[model samples]
Target: MRRRDFLRTAAVFVSGASVSLSALEFLDPGKVLAAHPQLRWAFLVDTHKCVGCGFCVKACKIENDIPLDANVTRTWVERYVIKKNGETVMDCPKGALDGYTSKLLDQGKSGKVLVPDKEVAQAFFVPKLCNHCELPACVQVCPVGATYQTADGAVLVDRQWCIGCGYCIMGCPYGVRFFHPVERVADKCTFCYHRISKGGNTACAQACPFGARRIGNLRDPDDPVAKTVLNQRVGVLRDEYGTKPHVFYLGLNKEVR
Candidate 1:
Protein backbone atom coordinates (compact mmCIF):
# COMPACT_ATOMS: atom_id res chain seq x y z
CA MET A 1 0.00 0.00 0.00
CA ARG A 2 1.06 3.60 -0.43
CA ARG A 3 2.58 5.44 2.51
CA ARG A 4 -0.45 7.69 3.08
CA ASP A 5 -2.85 4.76 2.76
CA PHE A 6 -0.77 2.83 5.27
CA LEU A 7 -0.69 5.75 7.65
CA ARG A 8 -4.45 6.16 7.44
CA THR A 9 -4.89 2.54 8.35
CA ALA A 10 -2.50 3.03 11.25
CA ALA A 11 -4.48 6.03 12.38
CA VAL A 12 -7.68 4.00 12.44
CA PHE A 13 -6.14 1.69 14.99
CA VAL A 14 -4.63 4.55 16.97
CA SER A 15 -7.92 6.40 17.06
CA GLY A 16 -8.99 3.96 19.73
CA ALA A 17 -6.49 5.65 22.01
CA SER A 18 -8.55 7.86 24.26
CA VAL A 19 -7.65 11.55 24.22
CA SER A 20 -8.83 12.25 27.77
CA LEU A 21 -6.85 15.33 28.58
CA SER A 22 -8.68 18.57 29.13
CA ALA A 23 -8.07 21.41 26.69
CA LEU A 24 -4.30 21.90 26.75
CA GLU A 25 -2.17 21.32 29.83
CA PHE A 26 -4.61 18.83 31.24
CA LEU A 27 -2.47 16.03 29.91
CA ASP A 28 0.33 15.18 32.27
CA PRO A 29 3.91 15.76 31.26
CA GLY A 30 4.14 12.32 29.69
CA LYS A 31 0.63 11.00 29.22
CA VAL A 32 -0.93 12.37 26.06
CA LEU A 33 2.27 14.09 25.00
CA ALA A 34 3.89 11.77 22.52
CA ALA A 35 7.32 10.48 23.50
CA HIS A 36 8.33 11.61 20.04
CA PRO A 37 6.67 14.89 19.11
CA GLN A 38 7.09 14.12 15.44
CA LEU A 39 4.67 11.19 15.77
CA ARG A 40 1.77 13.60 15.94
CA TRP A 41 0.27 14.95 12.75
CA ALA A 42 0.90 18.60 11.88
CA PHE A 43 -0.27 21.06 9.26
CA LEU A 44 1.73 23.52 7.24
CA VAL A 45 0.79 26.35 4.91
CA ASP A 46 3.31 27.87 2.51
CA THR A 47 2.06 31.38 2.06
CA HIS A 48 4.49 32.04 -0.76
CA LYS A 49 2.88 29.41 -2.98
CA CYS A 50 -0.78 30.09 -2.24
CA VAL A 51 -2.27 31.98 -5.18
CA GLY A 52 -5.52 33.02 -3.43
CA CYS A 53 -7.30 30.56 -5.71
CA GLY A 54 -9.95 29.67 -3.11
CA PHE A 55 -9.77 26.07 -4.24
CA CYS A 56 -8.91 24.94 -0.76
CA VAL A 57 -11.74 26.97 0.71
CA LYS A 58 -14.32 25.58 -1.69
CA ALA A 59 -13.08 22.04 -1.22
CA CYS A 60 -13.29 22.35 2.55
CA LYS A 61 -16.92 23.43 2.37
CA ILE A 62 -17.89 20.53 0.13
CA GLU A 63 -15.95 17.98 2.15
CA ASN A 64 -17.20 19.08 5.56
CA ASP A 65 -20.75 20.12 4.67
CA ILE A 66 -20.29 23.66 5.88
CA PRO A 67 -23.09 26.02 4.93
CA LEU A 68 -21.85 28.87 2.80
CA ASP A 69 -22.73 32.41 3.78
CA ALA A 70 -20.93 35.62 3.03
CA ASN A 71 -19.85 35.85 6.66
CA VAL A 72 -19.46 32.25 7.75
CA THR A 73 -16.35 30.41 6.69
CA ARG A 74 -14.33 27.37 7.73
CA THR A 75 -11.32 28.50 5.71
CA TRP A 76 -10.62 31.76 3.90
CA VAL A 77 -7.71 33.39 2.08
CA GLU A 78 -6.73 36.96 2.73
CA ARG A 79 -5.04 38.99 0.03
CA TYR A 80 -2.59 41.44 1.48
CA VAL A 81 -1.08 44.29 -0.49
CA ILE A 82 1.45 46.53 1.15
CA LYS A 83 2.29 49.98 -0.11
CA LYS A 84 5.73 51.58 -0.18
CA ASN A 85 4.69 53.84 2.68
CA GLY A 86 4.14 50.72 4.86
CA GLU A 87 0.36 51.07 4.71
CA THR A 88 -1.31 47.68 4.18
CA VAL A 89 -4.68 46.93 2.60
CA MET A 90 -6.33 43.53 2.92
CA ASP A 91 -9.48 41.83 1.61
CA CYS A 92 -10.95 38.35 1.08
CA PRO A 93 -13.68 38.49 -1.49
CA LYS A 94 -16.16 35.63 -0.86
CA GLY A 95 -13.31 33.74 0.70
CA ALA A 96 -11.61 34.07 -2.70
CA LEU A 97 -13.86 31.22 -3.90
CA ASP A 98 -13.22 32.14 -7.54
CA GLY A 99 -9.58 33.12 -7.11
CA TYR A 100 -8.04 36.49 -6.19
CA THR A 101 -7.80 38.56 -9.32
CA SER A 102 -10.50 41.06 -10.16
CA LYS A 103 -11.82 40.63 -6.64
CA LEU A 104 -15.15 42.10 -5.62
CA LEU A 105 -14.77 45.63 -4.31
CA ASP A 106 -17.02 47.59 -2.01
CA GLN A 107 -17.69 50.84 -3.79
CA GLY A 108 -18.87 53.53 -1.43
CA LYS A 109 -20.05 57.00 -2.40
CA SER A 110 -17.23 57.34 -4.94
CA GLY A 111 -18.21 54.02 -6.62
CA LYS A 112 -14.55 53.04 -6.86
CA VAL A 113 -12.10 51.18 -4.67
CA LEU A 114 -9.50 53.43 -3.07
CA VAL A 115 -6.84 50.71 -2.80
CA PRO A 116 -3.20 51.23 -3.65
CA ASP A 117 -2.06 50.69 -7.23
CA LYS A 118 -0.57 47.33 -8.33
CA GLU A 119 2.91 48.92 -8.34
CA VAL A 120 2.92 48.53 -4.55
CA ALA A 121 5.52 47.02 -2.32
CA GLN A 122 4.33 43.37 -2.17
CA ALA A 123 1.30 41.11 -2.14
CA PHE A 124 0.50 37.57 -1.01
CA PHE A 125 -2.28 35.29 0.22
CA VAL A 126 -2.60 33.98 3.77
CA PRO A 127 -5.17 31.29 4.34
CA LYS A 128 -6.90 31.15 7.73
CA LEU A 129 -8.46 28.23 9.61
CA CYS A 130 -8.52 26.68 13.05
CA ASN A 131 -4.92 26.22 14.14
CA HIS A 132 -5.65 23.11 16.28
CA CYS A 133 -3.57 24.63 19.04
CA GLU A 134 -1.80 22.43 21.53
CA LEU A 135 -3.45 24.53 24.19
CA PRO A 136 -6.67 25.58 22.55
CA ALA A 137 -8.63 28.41 24.14
CA CYS A 138 -11.85 27.21 22.53
CA VAL A 139 -11.74 23.94 24.44
CA GLN A 140 -11.06 25.78 27.66
CA VAL A 141 -14.08 28.05 27.33
CA CYS A 142 -16.68 25.53 26.22
CA PRO A 143 -19.06 25.22 29.16
CA VAL A 144 -20.73 22.06 27.92
CA GLY A 145 -17.66 19.93 27.40
CA ALA A 146 -18.36 20.04 23.70
CA THR A 147 -15.18 21.48 22.26
CA TYR A 148 -12.33 19.03 22.63
CA GLN A 149 -8.78 18.29 21.57
CA THR A 150 -8.11 14.85 20.14
CA ALA A 151 -5.16 12.68 21.08
CA ASP A 152 -3.71 13.23 17.61
CA GLY A 153 -3.69 17.03 18.13
CA ALA A 154 -6.95 17.91 16.39
CA VAL A 155 -9.32 20.35 18.05
CA LEU A 156 -12.93 19.35 17.49
CA VAL A 157 -16.42 19.75 18.81
CA ASP A 158 -19.18 17.33 19.77
CA ARG A 159 -21.86 19.02 17.74
CA GLN A 160 -24.65 17.18 19.52
CA TRP A 161 -23.40 18.42 22.87
CA CYS A 162 -22.58 21.96 21.82
CA ILE A 163 -25.10 24.35 23.36
CA GLY A 164 -24.56 27.23 20.95
CA CYS A 165 -23.36 29.51 23.75
CA GLY A 166 -20.73 31.07 21.49
CA TYR A 167 -18.32 31.17 24.41
CA CYS A 168 -15.78 29.30 22.37
CA ILE A 169 -16.37 31.81 19.64
CA MET A 170 -15.26 34.62 21.93
CA GLY A 171 -12.34 32.64 23.32
CA CYS A 172 -10.73 31.88 19.96
CA PRO A 173 -8.25 34.68 19.34
CA TYR A 174 -7.53 33.51 15.81
CA GLY A 175 -11.08 34.41 14.72
CA VAL A 176 -11.38 30.93 13.27
CA ARG A 177 -14.49 29.95 15.25
CA PHE A 178 -17.95 31.19 14.46
CA PHE A 179 -21.58 30.40 15.32
CA HIS A 180 -22.92 28.24 12.53
CA PRO A 181 -25.45 30.22 10.54
CA VAL A 182 -27.89 27.33 10.20
CA GLU A 183 -26.81 24.76 12.77
CA ARG A 184 -26.88 27.36 15.56
CA VAL A 185 -23.90 25.65 17.15
CA ALA A 186 -20.33 26.78 17.39
CA ASP A 187 -18.36 25.65 14.32
CA LYS A 188 -14.79 25.76 13.07
CA CYS A 189 -12.24 23.68 11.22
CA THR A 190 -11.53 20.15 12.46
CA PHE A 191 -8.52 19.46 10.26
CA CYS A 192 -10.67 17.11 8.23
CA TYR A 193 -10.82 14.61 11.10
CA HIS A 194 -12.84 12.00 9.23
CA ARG A 195 -10.44 11.61 6.31
CA ILE A 196 -7.16 12.09 8.18
CA SER A 197 -8.11 9.33 10.60
CA LYS A 198 -8.42 7.03 7.58
CA GLY A 199 -5.04 8.05 6.13
CA GLY A 200 -6.48 10.53 3.67
CA ASN A 201 -5.35 14.12 3.47
CA THR A 202 -7.58 16.98 4.52
CA ALA A 203 -9.67 18.19 1.60
CA CYS A 204 -7.99 21.58 1.58
CA ALA A 205 -4.55 20.07 1.25
CA GLN A 206 -5.72 17.66 -1.42
CA ALA A 207 -7.29 20.47 -3.44
CA CYS A 208 -4.35 22.89 -3.29
CA PRO A 209 -2.98 22.82 -6.84
CA PHE A 210 0.38 24.38 -5.95
CA GLY A 211 1.03 22.09 -2.97
CA ALA A 212 0.86 25.12 -0.69
CA ARG A 213 -0.76 23.18 2.17
CA ARG A 214 -0.05 19.75 3.66
CA ILE A 215 -0.41 17.45 6.66
CA GLY A 216 2.05 14.88 7.94
CA ASN A 217 3.12 12.96 10.99
CA LEU A 218 5.80 15.03 12.63
CA ARG A 219 7.50 11.94 14.06
CA ASP A 220 8.45 10.41 10.74
CA PRO A 221 11.87 11.94 10.06
CA ASP A 222 11.34 11.36 6.37
CA ASP A 223 8.11 13.33 6.34
CA PRO A 224 8.69 16.63 4.54
CA VAL A 225 7.02 18.53 7.40
CA ALA A 226 9.46 17.02 9.88
CA LYS A 227 12.41 18.74 8.28
CA THR A 228 10.52 21.81 7.12
CA VAL A 229 9.57 22.79 10.66
CA LEU A 230 13.14 22.54 11.85
CA ASN A 231 14.93 24.15 8.91
CA GLN A 232 12.46 26.49 7.27
CA ARG A 233 11.70 30.04 8.38
CA VAL A 234 8.16 29.38 9.58
CA GLY A 235 5.76 31.18 11.90
CA VAL A 236 2.35 30.72 13.45
CA LEU A 237 -0.35 33.28 14.09
CA ARG A 238 -0.59 35.05 17.49
CA ASP A 239 2.36 33.47 19.20
CA GLU A 240 2.04 36.16 21.85
CA TYR A 241 -1.08 34.37 23.13
CA GLY A 242 0.96 31.22 23.83
CA THR A 243 -1.38 28.98 21.86
CA LYS A 244 1.42 26.67 20.66
CA PRO A 245 -0.49 26.00 17.48
CA HIS A 246 0.32 22.95 15.36
CA VAL A 247 -0.42 24.76 12.11
CA PHE A 248 2.50 26.72 10.70
CA TYR A 249 3.23 29.05 7.80
CA LEU A 250 6.08 29.87 5.43
CA GLY A 251 6.84 33.27 3.91
CA LEU A 252 4.58 34.94 6.43
CA ASN A 253 4.77 38.69 6.03
CA LYS A 254 4.98 40.89 9.09
CA GLU A 255 1.88 42.75 7.95
CA VAL A 256 -0.40 39.69 8.22
CA ARG A 257 -2.56 39.27 11.32
Candidate 2:
Protein backbone atom coordinates (compact mmCIF):
# COMPACT_ATOMS: atom_id res chain seq x y z
CA MET A 1 0.00 0.00 0.00
CA ARG A 2 1.04 3.55 -0.52
CA ARG A 3 2.46 5.46 2.43
CA ARG A 4 -0.60 7.73 2.53
CA ASP A 5 -2.94 4.76 2.37
CA PHE A 6 -1.09 3.05 5.14
CA LEU A 7 -1.26 6.14 7.24
CA ARG A 8 -4.99 6.43 6.64
CA THR A 9 -5.64 2.87 7.72
CA ALA A 10 -3.55 3.31 10.82
CA ALA A 11 -5.33 6.56 11.67
CA VAL A 12 -8.73 4.88 11.40
CA PHE A 13 -7.67 2.23 13.83
CA VAL A 14 -6.16 4.74 16.23
CA SER A 15 -9.17 7.05 16.07
CA GLY A 16 -11.44 4.14 16.80
CA ALA A 17 -9.50 3.37 19.94
CA SER A 18 -9.26 7.00 20.95
CA VAL A 19 -13.03 7.30 21.26
CA SER A 20 -12.93 5.94 24.82
CA LEU A 21 -9.64 7.37 26.11
CA SER A 22 -10.82 9.92 28.65
CA ALA A 23 -12.30 12.89 26.82
CA LEU A 24 -10.90 15.54 29.13
CA GLU A 25 -7.51 13.85 29.23
CA PHE A 26 -7.26 13.04 25.53
CA LEU A 27 -6.74 16.75 24.83
CA ASP A 28 -4.84 18.71 27.43
CA PRO A 29 -7.07 21.45 28.81
CA GLY A 30 -4.26 23.32 30.48
CA LYS A 31 -2.09 23.48 27.38
CA VAL A 32 -4.44 25.88 25.71
CA LEU A 33 -4.03 28.25 28.63
CA ALA A 34 -0.28 27.93 28.66
CA ALA A 35 0.51 28.22 24.95
CA HIS A 36 -0.38 31.82 24.29
CA PRO A 37 -0.30 33.08 27.89
CA GLN A 38 -3.20 35.23 26.74
CA LEU A 39 -6.79 34.11 26.34
CA ARG A 40 -7.22 34.28 22.56
CA TRP A 41 -7.00 32.09 19.46
CA ALA A 42 -7.10 33.20 15.84
CA PHE A 43 -5.78 32.20 12.42
CA LEU A 44 -4.70 34.20 9.40
CA VAL A 45 -4.51 32.94 5.82
CA ASP A 46 -2.74 34.85 3.05
CA THR A 47 -4.12 34.21 -0.42
CA HIS A 48 -1.21 35.69 -2.31
CA LYS A 49 1.43 33.01 -1.56
CA CYS A 50 -0.57 29.79 -1.67
CA VAL A 51 0.69 27.33 -4.31
CA GLY A 52 -2.23 24.87 -4.30
CA CYS A 53 0.01 21.89 -3.39
CA GLY A 54 -2.62 20.04 -1.29
CA PHE A 55 0.14 19.25 1.23
CA CYS A 56 -1.98 20.80 3.95
CA VAL A 57 -4.80 18.40 3.14
CA LYS A 58 -2.49 15.41 3.33
CA ALA A 59 -0.89 16.72 6.48
CA CYS A 60 -4.25 17.26 8.15
CA LYS A 61 -5.40 13.76 7.30
CA ILE A 62 -2.18 12.34 8.67
CA GLU A 63 -2.12 14.54 11.72
CA ASN A 64 -5.77 13.99 12.63
CA ASP A 65 -5.88 10.41 11.35
CA ILE A 66 -9.13 11.04 9.48
CA PRO A 67 -10.67 8.12 7.64
CA LEU A 68 -10.27 7.83 3.88
CA ASP A 69 -13.90 7.14 3.01
CA ALA A 70 -15.04 9.97 5.22
CA ASN A 71 -15.72 13.35 3.66
CA VAL A 72 -15.20 15.22 6.90
CA THR A 73 -12.29 17.15 5.48
CA ARG A 74 -11.05 19.54 8.14
CA THR A 75 -8.91 21.43 5.63
CA TRP A 76 -8.69 21.66 1.88
CA VAL A 77 -7.66 23.94 -1.00
CA GLU A 78 -9.79 25.59 -3.65
CA ARG A 79 -8.63 26.77 -7.09
CA TYR A 80 -10.36 29.73 -8.69
CA VAL A 81 -9.66 31.15 -12.13
CA ILE A 82 -11.31 34.01 -13.96
CA LYS A 83 -11.57 34.13 -17.72
CA LYS A 84 -12.44 36.83 -20.23
CA ASN A 85 -12.56 37.18 -24.01
CA GLY A 86 -12.69 33.39 -24.36
CA GLU A 87 -9.09 33.07 -23.20
CA THR A 88 -7.36 32.51 -19.91
CA VAL A 89 -7.57 35.78 -18.00
CA MET A 90 -6.43 35.15 -14.46
CA ASP A 91 -5.93 32.18 -12.17
CA CYS A 92 -5.03 31.73 -8.55
CA PRO A 93 -4.50 28.18 -7.22
CA LYS A 94 -3.11 28.81 -3.76
CA GLY A 95 -3.82 25.63 -1.83
CA ALA A 96 -1.55 22.66 -1.09
CA LEU A 97 -3.23 20.48 -3.73
CA ASP A 98 -2.94 22.84 -6.67
CA GLY A 99 -2.78 20.74 -9.87
CA TYR A 100 -0.90 23.37 -11.80
CA THR A 101 1.57 21.88 -14.26
CA SER A 102 1.76 24.34 -17.18
CA LYS A 103 -1.29 24.48 -19.40
CA LEU A 104 -3.65 27.17 -20.63
CA LEU A 105 -6.06 28.44 -17.98
CA ASP A 106 -9.09 27.55 -20.09
CA GLN A 107 -8.20 23.87 -19.91
CA GLY A 108 -8.35 23.87 -16.15
CA LYS A 109 -11.38 21.98 -14.82
CA SER A 110 -12.43 20.03 -11.77
CA GLY A 111 -10.60 16.80 -10.81
CA LYS A 112 -8.66 16.89 -14.04
CA VAL A 113 -4.95 17.50 -14.38
CA LEU A 114 -4.39 21.24 -14.47
CA VAL A 115 -1.46 23.11 -15.98
CA PRO A 116 -0.59 26.67 -15.16
CA ASP A 117 -0.62 29.19 -17.96
CA LYS A 118 2.92 30.35 -18.56
CA GLU A 119 1.66 33.51 -20.22
CA VAL A 120 -1.01 34.22 -17.62
CA ALA A 121 0.25 37.20 -15.65
CA GLN A 122 -1.98 36.72 -12.62
CA ALA A 123 -2.56 33.36 -10.99
CA PHE A 124 -2.38 32.33 -7.37
CA PHE A 125 -3.81 29.83 -4.86
CA VAL A 126 -6.00 30.13 -1.77
CA PRO A 127 -6.18 27.63 1.06
CA LYS A 128 -9.54 27.17 2.83
CA LEU A 129 -10.09 25.67 6.25
CA CYS A 130 -12.14 26.12 9.37
CA ASN A 131 -12.37 29.78 10.37
CA HIS A 132 -12.78 28.91 14.06
CA CYS A 133 -15.33 31.65 14.58
CA GLU A 134 -15.58 33.63 17.77
CA LEU A 135 -19.35 33.62 17.74
CA PRO A 136 -19.74 30.35 15.92
CA ALA A 137 -23.26 29.52 14.80
CA CYS A 138 -22.44 25.85 15.30
CA VAL A 139 -21.82 26.53 18.95
CA GLN A 140 -24.98 28.58 19.35
CA VAL A 141 -27.34 26.21 17.51
CA CYS A 142 -26.27 22.99 19.19
CA PRO A 143 -29.36 21.98 21.10
CA VAL A 144 -27.38 19.37 23.01
CA GLY A 145 -24.58 21.79 23.85
CA ALA A 146 -21.99 19.57 22.23
CA THR A 147 -20.31 22.48 20.50
CA TYR A 148 -18.83 25.35 22.46
CA GLN A 149 -16.32 28.14 22.11
CA THR A 150 -13.14 27.75 24.08
CA ALA A 151 -11.52 30.34 26.32
CA ASP A 152 -9.12 31.13 23.51
CA GLY A 153 -12.01 31.80 21.07
CA ALA A 154 -11.78 28.60 19.01
CA VAL A 155 -15.01 26.71 18.45
CA LEU A 156 -14.74 23.06 19.49
CA VAL A 157 -17.00 20.00 19.42
CA ASP A 158 -17.29 17.31 22.04
CA ARG A 159 -17.67 14.06 20.16
CA GLN A 160 -18.71 12.19 23.26
CA TRP A 161 -21.66 14.51 23.82
CA CYS A 162 -22.68 15.12 20.22
CA ILE A 163 -25.82 13.27 19.11
CA GLY A 164 -25.04 13.41 15.37
CA CYS A 165 -28.09 15.58 14.78
CA GLY A 166 -26.33 17.59 12.05
CA TYR A 167 -27.60 20.81 13.57
CA CYS A 168 -24.16 22.34 13.64
CA ILE A 169 -23.56 21.45 10.02
CA MET A 170 -26.73 23.20 8.93
CA GLY A 171 -26.13 26.12 11.24
CA CYS A 172 -22.74 26.97 9.78
CA PRO A 173 -22.97 29.71 7.13
CA TYR A 174 -19.61 28.89 5.59
CA GLY A 175 -20.37 25.13 5.51
CA VAL A 176 -17.24 24.33 7.51
CA ARG A 177 -18.82 21.63 9.64
CA PHE A 178 -19.04 17.96 8.67
CA PHE A 179 -20.31 14.71 10.22
CA HIS A 180 -17.80 11.91 10.62
CA PRO A 181 -19.14 8.73 9.06
CA VAL A 182 -17.39 6.33 11.42
CA GLU A 183 -17.65 8.42 14.55
CA ARG A 184 -21.29 9.32 13.87
CA VAL A 185 -20.81 12.86 15.18
CA ALA A 186 -20.16 16.35 13.94
CA ASP A 187 -16.48 17.18 13.39
CA LYS A 188 -14.51 20.20 12.28
CA CYS A 189 -11.16 21.81 12.75
CA THR A 190 -10.27 22.39 16.37
CA PHE A 191 -7.31 24.47 15.28
CA CYS A 192 -5.41 21.30 16.10
CA TYR A 193 -6.56 21.53 19.68
CA HIS A 194 -4.23 18.70 20.55
CA ARG A 195 -1.31 20.70 19.21
CA ILE A 196 -2.32 24.28 20.01
CA SER A 197 -2.92 23.61 23.68
CA LYS A 198 0.48 21.88 23.79
CA GLY A 199 2.65 24.86 22.89
CA GLY A 200 2.63 23.87 19.25
CA ASN A 201 1.03 25.49 16.23
CA THR A 202 -1.69 23.82 14.17
CA ALA A 203 -0.74 21.17 11.61
CA CYS A 204 -1.87 23.34 8.70
CA ALA A 205 0.07 26.37 9.85
CA GLN A 206 3.16 24.28 10.46
CA ALA A 207 2.71 22.36 7.24
CA CYS A 208 2.64 25.53 5.21
CA PRO A 209 5.99 25.90 3.47
CA PHE A 210 5.48 29.54 2.53
CA GLY A 211 4.17 30.73 5.89
CA ALA A 212 0.76 31.34 4.38
CA ARG A 213 -1.10 30.48 7.57
CA ARG A 214 -0.57 32.24 10.88
CA ILE A 215 -2.05 31.43 14.31
CA GLY A 216 -1.75 33.50 17.44
CA ASN A 217 -3.54 35.10 20.30
CA LEU A 218 -5.79 37.86 19.05
CA ARG A 219 -5.78 39.49 22.46
CA ASP A 220 -2.05 40.25 22.28
CA PRO A 221 -1.54 43.59 20.61
CA ASP A 222 2.10 42.86 19.93
CA ASP A 223 1.47 39.58 18.14
CA PRO A 224 1.89 39.53 14.38
CA VAL A 225 -1.63 38.22 13.81
CA ALA A 226 -3.20 40.94 15.89
CA LYS A 227 -1.13 43.67 14.26
CA THR A 228 -1.96 42.36 10.77
CA VAL A 229 -5.67 42.51 11.44
CA LEU A 230 -5.36 46.06 12.66
CA ASN A 231 -3.10 47.32 9.88
CA GLN A 232 -3.95 45.10 6.88
CA ARG A 233 -7.00 44.89 4.67
CA VAL A 234 -8.10 41.61 6.13
CA GLY A 235 -11.48 39.96 5.43
CA VAL A 236 -13.57 37.17 6.80
CA LEU A 237 -15.74 34.85 4.76
CA ARG A 238 -19.47 35.65 4.71
CA ASP A 239 -19.22 38.28 7.43
CA GLU A 240 -22.95 39.08 7.02
CA TYR A 241 -23.73 35.65 8.45
CA GLY A 242 -22.90 37.26 11.78
CA THR A 243 -20.89 34.32 13.05
CA LYS A 244 -18.03 36.70 13.82
CA PRO A 245 -15.27 34.34 12.74
CA HIS A 246 -11.83 34.61 14.24
CA VAL A 247 -10.04 33.55 11.06
CA PHE A 248 -9.01 36.38 8.75
CA TYR A 249 -8.01 36.37 5.10
CA LEU A 250 -5.44 38.68 3.53
CA GLY A 251 -4.98 39.55 -0.14
CA LEU A 252 -8.28 37.98 -1.17
CA ASN A 253 -9.00 37.48 -4.86
CA LYS A 254 -11.11 40.25 -6.39
CA GLU A 255 -12.73 37.81 -8.84
CA VAL A 256 -13.09 34.90 -6.46
CA ARG A 257 -16.27 33.05 -7.53
lDDT of 2 by residue, 54-135 (tens): 7777788778877744545787776665443333344433223334554444324753444345434455666777788767
Q: Write the per-residue lDDT of candidate 1 for residues 1-257, one digit (tens) a residue.
A: 89999999889878755554453445466754554354577889999899888999989988887765546789889888787888877777777766676743433344535554665788788998888998899899888899998777889989899999999999999989988877778899988999989989999999999999999877787889868987888999999999898888998887999
Query: Candidate 1: TM-score?
Result: 0.82
- Candidate 1: Cα lDDT at 184: 79
Summed over model 1, clashes come to 4
User: How does each model score on lDDT?
Assistant: 0.83, 0.75
lDDT of 2 at 159: 86
How many clashes show up in model 2? Answer: 18
Q: How well does model 1 score by local distance difference test? A: 0.83
As for candidate 1, its clashing pairs are 8-199, 38-218, 38-219, 39-219
Backbone clash count for every predicted candidate, in the order shown:
4, 18
